[model samples]
Target chain A: MVWKIQGVEGENYLESIKNFLNQLLKSKNVDAVLVPKRFPDGNNTAQVLITDPGKLDDIDPLAPVQMVNSAQIVKELTKDPVKEKIASVLRPCEVRATIELIKLKQILDARLYIIGYDCPGVYNVKDYIEKLEKSNGIGKEGFTLSYVNSFLSGKQDTIRESCQLCTHFTGNSADINIAWVGSNSSDVFIEVNSEKGQSLIEGLAGEKIGDLIERNQKINKILDERKKRQENEIDDFLGFMQRCIRCYNCREVCPLCYCKECLLKPEKMGYSSDRYLRRATKKGQIKMPVDTVLYHLTKINHMAFSCVSCGLCEQACPMDIPLGRIYNVFGRKAQALFDYEPGRSLDDELPVATFKEDELKEIEDVKE
Target chain B: MGKNSVDFEPKIIAFLCNWCAYAGADLAGTSRTQYPSNIRIIKLMCTGALDPTYVIKVLLEGADGVLIGGCHPGDCHYINGNYKARRRVAILKSSLETAGLESERVWLRWISASEGVYFAETVKEMVEHIKKLGPNPLKMEWAI
Candidate 1:
């Protein structure tokens, strides 16, 4: 919208988020704003539930800059069946994860409201600070918004290989999509992607944004450049990932990884305490992480139709494995098979759990 | 056909409920009805006892086809096991195809205690179709 509203009373992105939380708390309808807080050691990211408006002042939405798919947390909250509507600010992957969870009936819809923003990118908290220090000689403790924004704007050194290729740079399916891709002179592209989004737009009572044809075209060009860059990075990632050390941080950080008893569980996987021993034995002698490929394949079998490509897995890797691109490549194939896009529609059934008679005729013919 | 070619023999596993499907197969045997011997039966207390993994693992282990024959929807000995089994198997079949496995490898059918001929004929048909496909590629070396 062409609203002349300052993001904060006087501050920038940080102040704007703080003000938004303040407004949310004073509003009678909102009960909570589920959020993430900067940890004490500040080495990793942790999710938190924020009820008090005072805590909003210290909240750092952009700190750590690590991506998380928060679908699981939102899905868990929705099942409470509360009368009070809850609001959550989420990453794009989190929104997509919630959509799949809603479709699976694991979560309820009416109880939650979502706010999403265009993702500049996220870092593996520790890796981000380390890289910032190494690249610019800025100490790890000195990293800030100006540092991150300069890097994201590409005025600084390039972003991680995975971030460059991310296709969903803009939020497409959120209730209220926040945009900051335009120049300081041009107005922000505040697009309402749904009925709830439109309501939030009305509630703001901001000046209506004129159709941003030229601005949108410019954004699309940037996105196209990002896509091409992502494709090359994805290729590099897939090849590099063959050297994985099998840390499960990627699975842990992923918002959509909500399997309570995933196949990797000891009871299900048969890989007991000897997991590392087996890997050591198989290292170059045979491919270690015996079912690394199978583990991914099984997950894809179950959840590819629901994958949001949040890329937290790649960010969370200690070994710098690009799990997100590996997933997105297969996810793209699986999504295309059903002609369905994750997070695009809540009413659509996950492709794995639903079938049509005409869908696999090629397999039938191949059988003959 | 090559001179050394062997006649196609399908390997099929049948999970028959004790109440109806088992009786139906028994009836077929008593009547001397000719049906495919490719089927090896596993009797379950109820068709609902059949695990979804059993259907998938058997296919992965080289069974050309699998059949779960239970009591008609309401006629389960355990009240509603067959219905639950139906829902899970239907979901599993779709999921298998999505994973690049063929869905036809898993099939679900209902057989009453009186439907001896139907059980026999269903097996015969499944065996014939699977014989044409030979073996599951997931079990074959060609599968990536």
Candidate 2:
């Protein structure tokens, strides 16, 4: 089912979303809400858990900055069962990552409402802060609304590289998808993608619009551009990876890299001083930070199949390696070979965890 | 150490699943089957238990090639272990390609315990392939 949450009078899309979230809080449909909101300083937005309706004043779900993938937040919130149902307003990448996390048993599905929105993509945190600084107290809502407008108008080019290349910007997997793409300024399109969404907005009033041709066209155009960029950017992977200092920030922020005891940890890597000296001796001279390539290779081997291409890892990288693109390229190939979509549905088994007996027969055929 | 490509004597690390490949290797030895002596075998409980890290480590340590020997499909003692191994190898190879490494340096083959001749032939074939591919760049190299 589809519904429209009418935009508030004399307010922009962001304000209307805040008003909708306020109503959601007041209606008691969910016991709590998790949405992005400006911090007290009002310069950045981060995901916040709100229980009081009045606190919705600072809500800014459409902010062009993402400090972290909120799937990690969902994992933390639902790792243990909660009695109260919590509605999480996420970007498409976050929702997909959350779904992948759910499959990995990192996040519990019960007592959680996954609410996602049409992602206009986001800027790297540093880039966002720079843009915020330049806007100079235009206020969070004002700045973000303009940023999103310019991005939608195709005048903005500061979106993170991963986001620009993202094809899965629609929150099709969410229970409730709050769509603004191709919708008029005065209303938001609420798509009930699942039964949970259907029951949640049971009495919400709005004209049920038919399938959006303009939105589909826009999505296709963006995807084509992204695919072209992805193709163009494929050559610089090795050169970019050469600069890695091996801080492991990429692993730290990766939503799919959910390991209780990560094998890539220095201790688990079984690195000894003697071993390092031996390696250095064997090579005559080894780089101070060894296993940089091996680290990436091992990580890709572990989670490439489950990768959601959220780009949080790339954002966290100080070395500026295009890890998001690299992982996505590798992930897409591996997932394609198995015909697996990481977060397409809960029913789709992870490629690594399950196997068909006759699958990958070419790998079985011994080359003589 | 200064040997030319013709007499390079490639160092091939073979991870053999205990249920089939390892037993198959043992059979080849007992049956006096002749094959290249270049392969160094590490017996694993199952190929599914083989981590990609082990393969990466050996390759980086300068092994000319990696040969993964799993049980034939449906013949794994752990049921679907070999099937899982196949999937992993596929993923590993794709990742290697993305890293701009030679993925062909790794080979996955199935050998049943009864197929001693096949085991010997596989070792000979893997050694020849590795010889043609030359030494792994990571082998005794300071840079990747």
Candidate 3:
């Protein structure tokens, strides 16, 4: 059933969401709530896990900036067996990443009520800060509302490239999707996609309405615009690799890069200085911080199938590599080879781990 | 062909599974089967143990080609190692293509331990094919 959430006493959509979550806390439906909130400075937002209902006053459910994928934090919260339930409000990509983590065994069996929202794309933290400065103290929540207005009308100017290309913005894979794309101004549509979501909202928030809201038409329209833009910007990854200094920031920020013992470590890369010099001697020259291409290729090989195309890697790059596009394009291709979509469900087989004894015949034989 | 092109003897790194291709290559030596001398062999317990990183390393390090030889289907010494190797090889090739490298330079062949003659012919064929593709472009590019 669809739940229509309207702010009590004429509050806006952002404020309305805060009220709903606070209701959940007050009613004792969940032990803790994980949502993005404005820092005490009132200019920026980051995710926080709150236990007190009073602390839910400044929550921002779908702000226009994301500093992390949030799945990494979800993993930390759930890795050890937990009895208390967590209601995590996440973006579409974070939902997908969380599912991948579950399949990767990063998240153990933890009770989580995943609340996803229709993300209107996010700005890179740097771009968001620059826009905030020009907003003239409209405040973080106020600045975020302005962006949502443009997004609803299909006039979003500058979001991260990965968000622009994202087809899964609604996060249907999530338990619950908070929708607002087609709604009039401050009304929120609570869409329950799974049984778990239905149970979480059993006796909470707004009267149960039989009428459902459809985000498909608007979502498809934005995806069409994004697909067209993607065709025009097929930039060369090699050009970006030349500028990569091997800081491994892309790997560091990736939610799927959960390996505790990374093969990319210098010791596991296992290159002695003597071997390094010898390789240079043989090649006549070698790039410093060696294995630049090797590291990237190996990383993509390792985790491309599980990649959620979140663009955190691109945001993390100091040299401004278009790693978001590079990884998404390549990851989609890798996934296509096996006809596997990461995080679609818990039952789908991982591309590398399990294989049919009879499938993938073409990959075996080399052409003459 | 230009004199330099004709003189180009492509360097090939062949990863051979010990129970099959490694033994097959050894059999070819004892059987006096003639193949190109360009191949440098590395043996592993199984093709599944051959991490794709090793293939990327040699290709980036300027080897002209890579050949991974294992038991034919339903014949892996480890039952499913060859099947897993096929998937890794596919992923590795996809990675190479995405990086703008020539993926055709890498080959995966199913050769049994008893097929000494078949193993020799596969090497000769790989060497000739790589000769036409020329040296790996990564050989001269210092930026990696």
Clashes of each: 2, 0, 0
Clashing pairs in 3: none
Of the pair 2 and 3, which is ahead by DockQ? 2
lDDT of 2 by residue, A31-107 (tens): 89999989988988889999998988878888888888899999999978879989999999899899998988889
Query: Model 2, which residues run further than 4 Å from truth?
Result: A6-10, A236-238, A366-368, B1-5
TM-score top scorer: 2
| TM-score of chain A by itself in each prediction | 0.78, 0.94, 0.94
Return the TM-score for chain B, candidate 1.
0.89
Model 3 off-target regions past 4 Å? A5-10, A205-214, A232-235, B1-5
C-alpha lDDT (0 to 100) for residue B78 of candidate 3: 92
Worst 10 residues of 3 chain A by lDDT: A1-10
Give each model's whole-structure lDDT.
Answer: 0.64, 0.83, 0.84
Q: What are the per-residue Cα lDDT tens digits for candidate 1 across A168-244? A: 66666777665655535323445667776555444443555566565477568767776665431134332354555
Q: Higher-TM-score candidate among 1 and 3?
A: 3
Query: Model 3 scores what on Cα lDDT?
Result: 0.84
Candidate 1 CAPRI level:
incorrect
- Candidate 1 vs candidate 2: the TM-score winner is 2
Q: How much RMSD separates candidate 2 from the native structure?
A: 1.9
Report the poorest 10 consecutive residues by lDDT, candidate 2 chain A: A1-10
The true-versus-predicted C-alpha distance at residue A78 of model 2, in Å, is 0.8
